[model samples]
Target: MKTVKQGDSGEEIAILNNALTQAGYSVKEGMTFTPALRETVVAFQQQRGLEPDGIVGYHTWEALLLGGESEATELADEDFSRGALLLDCETAALRAVQEVESGSRHGFVAPGKPTILFEGHIFWAQLKKRGIDPVQYAAQNGDILYPQWEKGHYRGGLKEYDRLEKARAIDREAADASASWGMFQVMGFNFAACGEKSVASFVAAMQQSARSQLKLFVRFIHQGGMLFALQRKEWATFARLYNGPRYAENRYDVKLAKAYAKYAR
Candidate 1:
């Protein structure tokens, strides 16, 4: 809990907010530090083998920097191509579920028959990369569970239309491809600049982006700062920093917040 000196960017402050919220600490929108926040920050420092000074200083920052290294290492061992595929598929599935939750009146669109298999395979592979047993999770809950298709062909029925639509929604959300590619669709970016225009190429870029985000999150947590303070998480804040605040709030922030809370944890 050692504190920063004057004139720091308060990066550590942003990190603190992320870690606190992830660990179930109550935080306000502005990341204003109250007496309780200070106490919690101090306690988190102590837990992480930092000094108990209640200030986010160098030692705490150092530990935070190192804490996510192992997690990164684990991710590094993954077959990223396969990982991307799985992530895309799971995203589609989750989106489908979300659609149901949202009460979309139309029958859920099934992700492309071929695409579903591709997405599911990729998702399962990614799950394995993270050391999560996808089969186990699939078996436990019918809704959240991954659907099993024979040779990637889903048997159609009355209720299935709804289910497929839900799955398609998840695919769209999970897809790392450009917006022009459509839901769970990967393509239509400057892929040639990166190397190739194949799905594999797109997957590689997506993985790189995902890895970058993971690094940023770890850095934020290590610095013991508030991401919101830096205009990182709040839709308006992110919009102001990256895009326009109004667009960020209206289009991106809420979705990102949901994903961050849902998948990044």
Candidate 2:
């Protein structure tokens, strides 16, 4: 809830600087919100639909927290001390999930835009429920769900940014809800499931640190009644519920098992 702006100097400045760097800006994390930091803030504000005032306020703070950067050192999830304590279940279990879901070891994101995967089917359903016809949309964009993803492959990153832009043009609310975001790939429609009130708020949370993502993941698990899966190491149940019925096609269950085993040590 704290606000930071230009000429600000202290630990918060360094933290903001680090988040900016992780978000792919060439700003240095320092004690002062120097000219370089101001530039980065302005660019981010413009990209995120905020006024380009170069001021880091409450709203921007929320966006940054939910964005693709982190103040935590990205380390092996197997390291028990690394943020896994936030999970009510065994740290290893959550770590295993993190390993498979994101694989973001060195940084929260690739030092640029947050990686995202848009689910066309989910979008289609959301639009239908919202009383918006989807046929015309399908004619324009085939398979928005990106049905072909398999194994380590995916359709995301800037490709998804473009997809979302188009979706926003048609229907902003539905478009935001359609895309799965962050290292966790949480769908925007599942915002409430992730403990957020609105899709926009959820997207902002995704822009924050990994710890925030994990918090949402935990909330999601609890809401979906899948906490037991993590507790018992029920990878099949967890994978199917988390990744959908076709979880076996991607062997997500098996990957979870392997990852859990590695972290269980």
Candidate 3:
């Protein structure tokens, strides 16, 4: 099979963009490469525990190219599983911590402090596996508008209130059963179907979920009737079928299709 190349297409760019964003860098739409972007990419690499060199070489490429679930388990078994694939427990944890802290700024909660620890590494790996592009999704819709902290913890008062309201708005407009979870955010429904009951189980089920979701999505496309209605540009109809045809239009958004489209290619 042929491998994807950099500067290939919008889809490729979207992948890189999503990876960079997940690694804690900001990239605006239609923004081409610049010294600043390169610097940011390098910073992202360093944070991800890849070499700090300002070039997207092997390690950086693997981090960018390898799917989250794949990398996590690969490292779990061996220090360097495949050729040029190396995992440093300390670096991975630090990267996860950085991501959690950055996400917190946007009012999302981190499971814990980002550090070189098994929990943090596992968390980060899960997020990558979820495969939802947070940036593109956020752009088409708006900020996630959800609480980072679990329910019933309102020590922050106004800040918490605002976050709750935003989250309510998002809940009003999105599906209740998303296929994503954790910091790496692997899709929960997909994960469960693939026999994953815990993050620890993800190592065994990761590839299966990835392959299955892709097939499921393709099958949905092939069905071409209900799927067509769901993929429509109109948010109301799309949201309706997203969960149920009459579940109220305010509870789901249709923009996810667009975001997914960018990566599905």
Candidate 4:
């Protein structure tokens, strides 16, 4: 993310605009950071205990992305035990996967928002699946509408919500399906596998808390036919399915094995 101020115009500003709106500040969604938006930013900063400099810098961005939500709700050991029981796997196995998938003890990037990665290429494919040509919107939104999956495009952390907000503007349903959310990193398109009726509902459930995410993860593994592999400690097979065909490129299986070993002890 870059520093955004009055007179600047771009996706960062647009993200700021959306943040302000989500934070309960009345602001129009657009790229230009006008005087009105600045006032809202300053007010938001003040309310959030920031410097109120009217500049959307790092701290301001953090506050806005957090959206005034309270602390993230953590999962208890009993939560993991329940998930393991449902999956017929050892609790350590679930713990290992959770540790590897989220790379954190907690799943949220903000108070209420789950960790997310918006895949632009997936958004393009999802739009096409719905008979919507992503190319038509490519001119103005090249960042979030590419035709092929490409690595390294991730803005990472809360900035991923920026990509998500932009993609949502293009097509909400497809945009929702394009993100991998929460501790287990379940793709929204796998809503049915996670026992959700719709992608929108899946996203809603993901935002609920880490425990909800864990339940969805268990459902996904069971429904997706990966329960046996998980229970048997089949790291290679589980990694191939969970992380995609090129899982070897990042040694996901090896990482999973190492993590599982540590927790199983």
Point out the worst 10-residue segment of candidate 2 by lDDT: 145-154
Tens-place lDDT per residue, model 2, 97-205, is 7778767643244543455776667777778878988886777666453234432323455666776777777788888897776666677888998879998888777
Residue-wise lDDT of candidate 1 within 8-97, one digit each (tens)?
A: 334445655665666556665334555666777677777777777767654454344323323121223232222222222233223322
56-106 in candidate 3: lDDT tens per residue?
Answer: 553465556443442221122122121112121122222232233222212
Model 2 local distance difference test score? 0.69
The model with the greater lDDT, 1 or 4, is 4
Error of 4 at 39 (Å): 62
- Answer with 1 or 3, whichever has the higher lDDT: 1
| lDDT-best of 3 and 4 | 4
Separately for all candidates shown, the number of backbone clashes (residues 3 or more apart, or on different chains) is: 32, 11, 22, 0
lDDT of 4 by residue, 221-240 (tens): 87798878899999999998
Evaluate residue 223 in candidate 2 and report its C-alpha lDDT on the 0 to 100 scale.
Answer: 73
lDDT for each candidate structure: 0.38, 0.69, 0.35, 0.82
Best of the candidates, TM-score: 4
Give TM per candidate: 0.24, 0.64, 0.24, 0.71
Best by lDDT: 4
